[model samples]
Target chain A: MSATVHIADVVKHYGKVEAVKGASFDLAEGEMVALIGHNGAGKTTLMKMMLGLIRPSRGTIAVLGENPAAGEFSARRRLGYLPENVAFDAALTGRETQAFYSRLKREPVKDALALLDVVGLGHAVKRRVDTYSKGMRQRLGLAQALIGRPRVLLLDEPTTGLDPELRQTFYDVIQKLAAEGTTVLLSSHALTELEERAGRVIIMNRGLKVADGTLDELRRIARLPTRIRIKVADLPPSGSPAWLPTATPYRRINGHIVEIDAAPDEKLDLLRRATADGSAVQDLELIPPSLDELYAHFLRQAERPQ
Target chain B: MNALITIAAKEIQQAIRNRWVLAATLLLAGLALSLTFLGSAPTGTVGARALDVVIVSLSSLTIFLIPLIALLISHDAIVGDMERGTMLLLLSYPVARWQVLLGKFLGHLAVLAFATCLGYGAAAVALLITGSSFDGEGFAAFAAMIGSSVLLGAVFVAIGYLVSAVVRDRGTAAGLCIGLWLMLVLIYDMALLGLLVLDQGRNISGGVLSALLLLNPADAYRLFNLTGFANVSLFSGMAGLAASSTLSVQALLTALVLWTLVPLACATLAFSRREL
Candidate 1:
């Protein structure tokens, strides 16, 4: 598969401050990728550069195999975008906003109505945008981007301020689009939200791409330690000798419970040996390295000295 | 072409539905009607010529109402969107920046032209109902009045968009647009009068006057509409005093074109760089 988005040593600067410091990455066609980073980490800048809204200070960026700054309408025709803060003309009703965008994109008028239905704005179509709540307006924005059958969708914090149900609806729509061979590149400050939805993640910090891979791949790269909590009905004395030699850094939470971080391979063996002693074991809970922890680890590395 | 029409249609819908725009347009129309009636005072045959008086009132009133409407219509073209965060949505479509600018310009011009025609037409109908004699010259003058007002309105709309593009906030854009209008439409005329008074009999002929007229879009508009009428010599003499010859029609047209170009170009450049 061809790379839909290719950024080669892209450097973007705002005068004295560098928003992106020679960042480079690529996304293959039909992939759902997430860009997670802290505020001012150049995620917005990079996304804008891809959409031809901003020019890079240095380096090359190819979105759908074209230099974005050319402002080529052909390239834009193939892409759809939902900005972080989606706003509409207050005077226009939801139907009107959708219709205007559809007309501008040269799409079928019915597409606008269909998108409104999909985004759950069909009932509110006649209401002016000024009366729309934040979530309603966002849905309208999504409806517009869905017009013209675009091939690539660039969404910036697509679910900001959305309730949990609506957010899930957004993810379902994204998944449906991606399954239909549409490439999606989404950026959001909400890591957990993206973690559950994105097929792959790109972690950025200080305008640099620190990690980019599947969840398993990133977890291995970041080496974020695993956490497991064990609860025992009766406390084991120091002389009980139930613990394995590998559980060296294990700490007792209380008289009965203990918490420890161990390698994935060693975790089961450690647990088996601990329970083998049968010193009144109660229950155990294992927490793997989630995308949130991986994100924090990369962000911290980008901030600290290696 | 469809893109342009699409944008224009949206702009018209937006302007019509906006309470503030509707209010401003109505207010200007009301003022236009009031000014028309103000010129109905009974005077000598020359002054009592209601058509001439109406023409003068219109010429003067448009100096204020044209800019007021222009400012109201266009001072929010880009800045308002940026502030409200709607600009990004507009930009995300496959529409080009130039299309947005041109479509907005045409939309505003259409609305203003319609409003002006309504006001001017109402005044004309009122004059006819009042038994005012309709002379050929008076009719021609009235047409020129409407034409010049539309041109002047278009020029100021471009200026307002330019100011809106450069300023980030709506309030600042409004203030700056209004300030520039006052300086050009109000203060520039006064300043020209002061200059003429100071340089009386100094061979400040029409060339200088024409050059100054070219420099000020407001003055260019005044000269264009008010020339060949009752006080033609007052303006032509001013042109003569400031320069060797009277202002050329060609030169005036060029100046007006430049008036539309400079502000529009600035607006385009500013908008292209803006972080919408």
Candidate 2:
């Protein structure tokens, strides 16, 4: 896939503290990538460098095939960004704020105003922003970022104050945009929320890119144990089960529930063995490593010395 | 160019919504009208043209009042945006940083100009309607007074932008701006007064004194209005200085224009280097 954003060895230093330390990554065209990390892990700084709001101390970043730090607006007009703490003049009505951004973007004001309905802010468009709640303001921020049908979107903590229903609506819009070939970068701390939506995730810890891959790939790299559970209609009353595998150990979670721990390679064999006897096992459950687990594992691995 | 106008238009809209325009206009009109009537009272007893005498009084008032008003309106224009996080949003758009600074400066200058015209215009019209007779030269002096008053406001607005660009917070910008007003209008001349008294018209000759007066924008504005015209100068009690002063009207006008440009250029330069 062709890359839309190519970041090479970018580092940003503030006084003695380095916010981003030789970080490197690429975003493919029409890809939705999630940047997950804790607070102060350099997520916002990285996004700012991409937006050309701040210059990096070393290396380079390119957006839409143009150098972002060159202070040129030719590429920026096609890029959209929603800062973490979005702020607007409180006296301006929602519609007025939208109008101003549309003018800045040099697009038709009507087209920008139409985005208000898409973000579910059509009802409160006439009210001043100071009267809107945090969620409403977030939606307005989203509407502003959607101006001019931008080709690339950089959203920081996009779903911070959104309700679950609005969050779903928000992702639906993102999915539609991605379907139209808009490259999206979501920088957030919401791991679970992005696990299903984002095809690729980049986990950061203390300004270092600890892991960058799909969930399944990271889980495989982590090498954590997989869990398998079987519910039996009848519990074997004997001290040991004759049907149980000899090599793998089994523990009893309850009278009818038997749990088995399997390594990554041994997972298929354990599953085949448990399903071989249909009369013994009533229900089976297999739990793979979750993203939260993978995140913790990667953070730990990143801290270890070479 | 379009971006510049759009940003400036937003500032104008903000001023209207904030009631800054109305307040400025009302304040200037009240002060100018009071000065026109109350100041002209001495003219009836002294046998001088009422409007020309009012021009002399209002020129001195502009020296003290316009700079403070300009600073009060513009001191927070840049720093407040950075503090509020709006500057980031504005910069994210496809516009240059200098455009933002220039747009805000133009919008604020327009606001000040509007207030100066309407506020002092009401007094000028009231003087004419009250049957106060004045010739073409007297009216010309009144017009110059209004025009130079706006220029003085522009100078302070530009300085306020410099303070706003350099300071990190609105509180500090406001503090420095107030201190600037004090120094230029009150303290600078007070110190100059002591210097002139000590000089005894010997070491600091009239040429040196005129150049020193040009250092402060208020003094430049005073020389342009109060001393440029004969009738205004006689009534303004600056006849001695006007006769001996070598600084011409054109030079004082150029000084006011430079006062506006130098600070505005500094503000643009300072804001461009800023991280935000």
Candidate 3:
């Protein structure tokens, strides 16, 4: 599949301060990419460049095969953006706001209004935006961004104000869109939330993309030890398990449970040995490096002098 | 073009929903009607036509009130949107930056035109209902006053847009707009008068005086409405200045239009280059 969005050597400078310093990435069609970073890590800046809200000081960005910053960029109709802390006109009703955005996107008003219900805002469609709660406004923002069924959707902190159920519904809608070949790039601080949703993750730190890969790929690169917890059936009151590998260290939680940090290559061997007879181990659980840990690991790797 | 209209329509819808249209219309109508009754009272003694007197009074009112009203509505158009984070989303659409600027300009101008026409039209209608007698010349002058008042409001709206585009926040835009209104409407003419007195006709000639008058949009609007018609100029006691002045009606109107276009262009340029 071709890249729906492309960036190469993108450098954005705000005076002497560089916001995005020489970053390069491409998002393929139907890819759900999470842009995870701390605040001021240039995630929003990169998204704005794709939206053509600001021109990069150097390098080029293409969205839908057109330069987004070009004056006559025709691909804008097929691009949707939800800004951080998304805002709408307080004086307008939710329906009016949706219709306004629909008109701008040259989409049918009926379809756009229907998205309000899809985002679970049907009950408050007629209420003024000022009266709506933060979550409702976020739903309205999401509905607005969904107009025109944009092929490329860029959302910054989209799930900030959403409840758990709404977040589930939000991910369901996004996953459906991605399934239909919509390229999704979202930036958020919620790593755990994105861990299960995003198909791939790009980690940024200090205006640089430090890591980009699937969870397993990043895990392979970082080589952080996997954690394994084993509940033994019959453990001596004072002695450790004889089957425990001597190369890897183990921590005792209590009489029956012990947690061990297994290197990636040794995890399967240890698990097999512990469950070899099916009599010594009552339960076993393996936990890999989470996105949060990977995020910190990558940031630290980027920060270290190499 | 469709995007332009969409943005403009949104602005108009917002103004209506916020009661800006109703409030501006009522304020202008209330003041225009009161001025019509009170200012025309002396017309009976002076033997001046009531409509001509009303035109003069309304022209002066426009010089002060219209700019303030225009600024009040427009000073926050760009900066407020940027601060609220709406402009960032709006610009993400297919619409060009100039389209947003011009679209909002047209929308605010429409709002001002509606208020000016209906508010001042009520006064004219009231005079007719009261059986005030006036010739075709008086009617023409009344129409010109209303037209120029809207034009004058457009000038300030464009100025406010320029301020909005250049300022960092709404508070600074508001402060700058008020300062501009005072400088143009009140302080500009006073300072000019002082300069003329100091010069005592030695350095300033008739040509120079005309240029000076055209420098301020309020003065240009005042000159166009008050002195464009002989009947209104005579009643307002500007006939001598009208005769001596080299500025023509077309020149004054052009000055007002240029006042609007230049700042609007500058605002568009400023806004297009502004980083959201």
Clashes of each: 12, 0, 0
Residue A75 CA displacement from its true place in model 3, Å: 0.9
Query: Please, what are the lDDT tens digits per residue for candidate 2 over residues A217-249?
Result: 888888988888888878876454556777667
Docking class of 1: medium
**How is the predicted docking of candidate 3 categorized under the CAPRI scheme?**
high
Worst 10 residues of 2 chain B by lDDT: B39-48
TM-score for candidate 2, residues paired by index: 0.96
Candidate 3 residue runs with Cα over 4 Å from true position: none
Candidate 3: tens digits of C-alpha lDDT, residues A1-306? 999999999999999999999889999999999999899999999999998889999998999999988876479888888899999999999999999999998899999999999999999999999999988988898899899898999999999868898899889999999999999999998899999989999998989999999988999999999999999878877756888766667888877898998889988888888888568888888899999999999999998985
Q: What are the C-alpha RMSDs, in order, of all predicted structures?
A: 2.9, 1.9, 1.2
The interface RMSD values of the models, given in order, are 1.3, 0.9, 0.9
Model 1: per-residue Cα lDDT at residue B129:
86
Provide the lDDT at B152 for model 2.
96
Model 1: per-residue lDDT, tens digit, B1-276?
788889988888888897645665576667767766766755334455777666766777788778887887899888887888777767766777878888888888888887788778778888888788888877887887887788888888999999988886999998898789889988998998899899994966766766877788877776666554644324334444333437665666678778888889888888887765
Where does the lowest 10-residue lDDT sum fall in candidate 1 chain A? A238-247
Off by over 4 Å in 1: A229-241, A251-257, A271-284, B43-48, B230-245
Error of 3 at B1 (Å): 1.2
Q: Residues B7-55, candidate 2, lDDT per residue (tens digit)?
A: 8888888898889999999999999999998988777877789988888
